[model samples]
Target: MELSTLKDAFDRASKKQKVSSSKVQEVIDQVGREIESAILKLQSVDSDQKSIFIDLRNKLVEISPMSQLEGSQKDLHIGLSKYARILEKHFNPDISKAYRNVDFDSHTVNQIIATHLYRHGLSDLGDFFMHESKEPSVIANAALKLQFLEMYKILDAMRSRNLEPALNWAATHRDQLLQNGSKLELKLQQLQFVEILQKQDKKQALAYVRGHLAPIASIHKVEIQKLMTCLLWAGRFDQSPYADELLSETHWDKIIEELTQQYCSLLGHSYESPLSVAVAAGFQGLPTLLKMASVVMAAKKQEWQEMKQLPMPLDLGREFQFHSSFVCPVLREQGNKENPPMLMPCGHVLSKQSILKLSKSSSRAFKCPYCPLESFVTQCRELHF
Candidate 1:
């Protein structure tokens, strides 16, 4: 609601500003025209110079261009002042009150920044940062730079409609890609076949189908059949029914994403750079942390930076969730090394401490907290996140 109000205020201020500027420009143009006319009259008038000057001065006074400009400027200033007040009311500029001083390993932070740079195809900047930081030995993922450089080279070729490099890489990693349930090789070949068909070269397209696509034709019958059908349209494939599916630029984007995923998988890495994910997660969580720091921690006179666990749970989106976590229903506590989650034989989970308390130190059986089934503490197994 606040954001909507702020936006409305901004729009009003912008519209007023534009109107004022237009009014000022109109006044200036009118004044300029009057001055130009007076100049022309003065050049032509040889006998009535004093009379001409009096008439020009009267014309300027009648228009009152300075008054008009001042009115417009005043309106603009009032609108801006109101907008500034609204901004001040809506936003808190001093965020330092929410800050907490925590000790972090400088080397680890530098490595993360350097890795992020390299992952984004900024090897030169990464190298410069490392050299300047005097952490040349901290380039632990230097090999990743070369791998990402090669990936960028292939992506660059793909942007120019050249598929050779990508095709070669896909073919070389065929077995590994297949093992990962990736059909990138077939997709690349299908694109190549389409490119051939687009040239109206039925013979070459058929030959490509026979040599490059025939082996994979058995499992991908439907896709291969679609490609075969495109041969009928030849050069006019853009007008064909399959044109929307095969010729869409989104196909290239999807293929590029798939190739990147497979490449990262082969390199034993996640498709998203870890540093990027961490930053995104942090950005999403910062607001909640700030609120907590200002309201809860400040009231309690506690330092959140010195605590290992947060006072409250942060509700992040699914994309930031990489693993499962368990909170014991009995004790209402999260699983940890000292109090790990224990799965009961009744298919209910509880923290180890909860189980111990319920079963009287494994000496007696107790009913499950979630179910009526009885279970011994010895039957409960520890669960790892």
Candidate 2:
């Protein structure tokens, strides 16, 4: 909503500028025409030279083009002042207000930055950064960098319609991909089959399907049937019923994303780099943090940086929420490793500390806080969030 208001303000300022420019141009043209008329009158005069000079001077004074020009310029200046104020009101250029001081290990910070750079295929920058930071360990351990480099190489090949590398990767990781409920191998072969069919090579397409796609046909019957039907529209798949689905560039993009996700999974990392996720979450929460900081300062309260958590909740989007969390209703505290949530046999949940206290640190029966059902401490299992 604030972005929309800023855009509207920008539009108004732009419109005002255009109007001011047109007004100034009109005033200049009118003044030019009056001066030209005065010059013509002076040129056509047949009277004595002194009389003609006096009449021309009087006409120039009557026209007063300088005053008109000044009025137009004043309007333009007023419009410019309003535009400046609008920009100042809508845009907050100083982000430092949202910043908080925290003690972070310089080495750890550098490692995270270097990893982010490498994860995004900026190995050159990553290497240079590690070199400058004097972090030999990061440079020496090239496993992570090599893994991402291979992923990038496969993605680069996919961009050029060369699926061989990706297909080979999928084939090598077929078992793991199937374990993760992935159809990447089948998808890659399907793309290959379509590519062959697109070239009017039905015989080779059939041969490729038999050797590569037929094995997965039993598992993905519908998908395989759709691909097989494409044989009738060989070299003219664009006019086929499946054109919208099979011929879209979106398929290539989706396949690339899938491959990257699987590759990252195999590497024991999230699809997005941890550093990138943290930065994105921080960027989204900055405005709220800044507003809170202002209020805290106005109230003469203690520094927010000293607090473990914010006074209010930050309304981050669903994408930022990566996992489920549990807060014990009995103690009104969040679950942690030391005081983890426990699920009672009766279906009620409470913190370990709460259960221990209720059961007097023994395996005795106690009434559930949330329900009338009773259960023994031993019957409660620790729940992981």
Candidate 3:
């Protein structure tokens, strides 16, 4: 039945002597429970309960006039207003689409607008009512459009706090906006910015920064700070003035050390066998003092070949001695003591068969099966296979 007609009938029934007020209250309570139950069901990942909840809430509001006693009329009106807002906040878009061609009575339109504004805020109504005032039809259309926007904007804003609700909404509603042009416009701007940056036109880059900051600076302080940092990092601005304020002494020291080490490593030999041997021997063999010495030596030599080549599990199988960098013939699963083998960084083992295959696969470069590291069999190749 139409909401208006249903409400009219209930209003008349409440005033009739034949219908008890208790029975009217019973129906209202039952419908309210149904509305809540539908809401909970809609929270699930696979629910299609929007229509059910809307129907129940509509019935509840329609019966409110008949069910509300003398002392509860104000409370009942407030409850109806809350229901309208909840439905507009959550289910209005679907309701609008479903009844797109149908004419709405004033009471239904008023309920939908009140609900949408109460739940979604009023910012969204401006676009839909650009050509019309707050008349019933205009308000209904605006409210529907606002609901559609809120459905996405609200969920997007909530993503950092709770991901599941947004994920479920996207899964269900993304297809409906497949032809939407909003994302396409955003992508175009990103592409244009990347192209301009690639051209290395400093004049154009500054202009772009100015354009963005003019509008965004007042609205987003954190974003403005990040933008300025990026400009400084790219050498577009003088960073010396803010260096002490932005970076700690420890951070500056670490940065200098890292850059110096990298410069040295790139200039010198690729690997250091002695350093690898010391590390592979075990923590006892490569004490903190020795490790520090190795770090200094590698920095001086500008190399890291030895450190990168060391096996992931240096103390594999207690069979090999400290000086040896060869594979063992035994294979053992984790937690097994007998014939124990060590797992490599690549997740492959140095089993007798596996080691043999690796040795023969490439003369210069072969990657481990479990991890991607260039490796070659140096010693004990003949003993393994």
RMSD of 2: 3.9
After superposition, candidate 1 runs with Cα above 4 Å error: 43-47, 88-91, 137-140, 214-221, 295-301, 304-313, 335-385
Please list all clashing residue pairs in model 1, or write none if there are none: none
RMSD of each: 3.9, 3.9, 32.3
Q: Please report, as a residue range, the 10-residue window in candidate 3 with the lowest summed lDDT.
A: 181-190
Q: TM-score per candidate, in order? A: 0.81, 0.81, 0.17
Candidate 1, run of 10 with poorest lDDT: 89-98
| lDDT of candidate 2 over 1-385, digit per residue (tens) | 2778667767776776787678768766766776676667667747365765676677667767678667766776776687677666545567787788888999889988998898899999998998999987643449889988999999999999999999999988988999999999888888888888989998999888888876677888888877888889987888999887767999878988999999999888889989988989998888777777777645767676677777878988989977656788878888888999898998888899999899885667888877888888888898876
- Per-candidate clashes come to 0, 0, 9
By lDDT, the better pick of 2 and 3 is: 2
Q: Considering only N, C-alpha and C atoms within 3 Å, which residue pairs clash in candidate 2?
A: none
Return the clash pairs for model 3, or none.
84-115, 85-115, 264-302, 265-302, 270-305, 271-305, 272-306, 346-370, 346-371
- Runs of candidate 3 with Cα error greater than 4 angstroms are 1-245, 269-326, 329-348, 352-385
TM-score of 3: 0.17
Estimate every model's Cα lDDT from 0 to 1. Answer: 0.85, 0.82, 0.44
